[model samples]
Target: MNKIKKIGIIGAGNMGEALISGFLKSKIFSPQDVYASEIIEKRRKYITDNYHIESFDDTKKLVERSDLIIISVKPHNVKDVLESIRDNITPEKILVSIAAGIKLDFIRKNLPEGIPIIRVMPNIACFVREGMIAICPSDNTPKEKLEAVKEVLSILGRTIILDEKYFDAVTGLVGSGPAYIYLIIEALSDAGVRLGLPRDIAITLSAQTILGAGKMVLEINEHPAKLKDMVVTPGGTTIEGLLEMERGRVRATIIDAVIKATERAKELSKA
Candidate 1:
């Protein structure tokens, strides 16, 4: 029989809850194999009641028992969380952090030298198991542990292993990119409404269109420009809309937004 991996999660916020949901649904880990540390009494009750996993108010106790620990707290709370569990971290354990702007060195400075660490950027889409997760593992992280994380995170859609140097940019493009797509979706829905469609129908059409277009880009494996060309015929309605978008420099503006967000991510780490 295969050995079941024991996992512990620190923090019970949205991201933490998403991971628990993802982990359990994957069936890679069982309820008894998972533990959650939540300071809030209400959240502690919620996790135990809903998921039937062991929930604790003390993070250190959770760290001592689990084989793998996922630090899912916010960026600002990372240092505090690290300090709380650093003494308990063992060489055999793998610590995965989902907090943005917290670097591997920052985590290493707080913990014992050579403690295995993996940093991942997971977006809100993880709640729906359609997230684009970017992972950057430290030199000390074992291959087996990295593979374990990969298998578990597969429940939350596609996962990519990226250079730590590009993490901030990756966070900007995919981590924060969902909000940008949402804006476009809302605008498209508004356009449909302006054309006399009911609000619900407009929203459904706009959302499904984005979903279909995303699938095409992933499945077709053609240059986006080439795909856009396929949609335009001689001189058509699509061309007119494309010209308007170009005139407004919509593409360029979005590109600049990614750069700006990346810069901001770096800025957060400085303080």
Candidate 2:
């Protein structure tokens, strides 16, 4: 597909602002090429003043002016926004929806027939540009268009093209995964504090350790179990900690968390 010269975002919330920030910071699109539509006057003003991009209260106007339109509004608001822009959306404009639990077929049914639609599940980490994103395109979307969306998302972090069927699991894993990891970090910090470490130092060390371990898994491209074994020496403190965690069924609990979250995602999609 041809280069996407302009982008319109339908929300000015955290994720929407993150995309605008990512696009500008990556130099993929200049401020002039980006526009946002936000309902609140304060939010629109903030986007305009801070990002130096055009902001509107009218979704139709944003869609009319943009080449690529990102539906960044909450899932419940998606239908209304699509209804408002249905007349303005044409074959040339690419539509990408980042609203959680909103499927590609649902978007297709709401929009003009054969309008290219791409569904994306991106985590909150996007604000920091360390996001994990999953994209699934409708059958009508061309390969180039899908690639273009992926190219734009790559600016935020790793992008994976997956079948839409896996999106609920993706939502459970990477989308809600950050919160689980943050909880772990907090628990580790608490453990350190109990062991007599200063609170500030303990929190720093706990956060850094988790960050380094994640980096290792990504850079080394090795199975996490093998990496765990690498750190487990005979009669070591790590082994003792691992044993305690096993006794507490931490592994099973984490797995259950993902399973429960996936079920909730499925329920939300139906709503």
Candidate 3:
């Protein structure tokens, strides 16, 4: 049996709904086991209608009903959400915050003492149960409690344990990584269209190519550089594209993008 019998999501926005979708899809929990609270009637209705889960605008009631509460609201709205239901959150309940840039200490400060809070950085892929989730628990969070969070997260995707210090980078790299890949996909689709492929075919080809390449890298268990060499046969057309990418500084630019996003997350933490 799952330790998490009832789970409540405080915000039924994109990430929250995605979590709900992935969780139910995993069959680790059923619709009756899920709960959500969304201020937006349309989003709340969507969750209830599609997932058939109970949801309301009352965060306090949601907290009361759920033993495992997920704070999935936006970073800017985190403080307000915490404030509204801090008293209802007891030590027994495990609070998991998925709002990027929010630290364990900040959530700890907002809640009563002894609340086992876990900070998780989950990517957009959680919508499809293929996310890479990074988890860091607060000081003194019980080993079993941490494990419980991990168990819940495992259904969504891979979970890695790390120090809280690395969370901002995880937020930048994984939490925001999907968007970068999406941009790449979009560019590839456009490039295909420019090369005379139909738009729909271009999109499918671009998406599938990226997906296949990523799957190869994972399943092959070889260094990415080695994998790249495999694709770049002697004097092949791939080398021309690789050379152009080198000239365009694609590698360095991606590095810079992650760094910039990490810095921004740190800034948000301070705010």
Q: State the C-alpha lDDT per candidate.
A: 0.86, 0.91, 0.91
| TM-score on alpha carbons, each prediction | 0.91, 0.94, 0.97
lDDT string for model 3 (1-271, tens) is 4577889999998899889999999987899889999999988888899999999988988888887999999999999999998878888889999998899989888888898999999987998999999998888789888888899899999899989899889988999999999999999999999999998999999999998988998899988899899889798899999999999999999999999999999999999
Off by over 4 Å in 3: none
Model 1 has a clash total of 0
The TM-score-based order of candidates, best leading, equals: 3, 2, 1
Q: Total clashing residue pairs per candidate? A: 0, 0, 0
Top of the candidates by TM-score: 3
Clashing pairs in 1: none
Regarding TM-score, does 1 or 2 come out ahead? 2
Error of 1 at 262 (Å): 0.5
RMSD of 3: 1.1
Candidate 1, residues 14-124: lDDT per residue as tens digits?
889988887787776779889999888999999999989999998987998788799998789899998899787888888899877889888988898878899999887
C-alpha lDDT of candidate 2 relative to the true structure: 0.91
Which residues of candidate 1, in runs, are more than 4 Å off?
1-4
For candidate 1, give the lDDT of residue 122: 84
Kindly list the per-residue Cα lDDT of model 2 for residues 95-155, writing each as its tens digit. 9998878999899999899799999998877777889999999999988888888888888
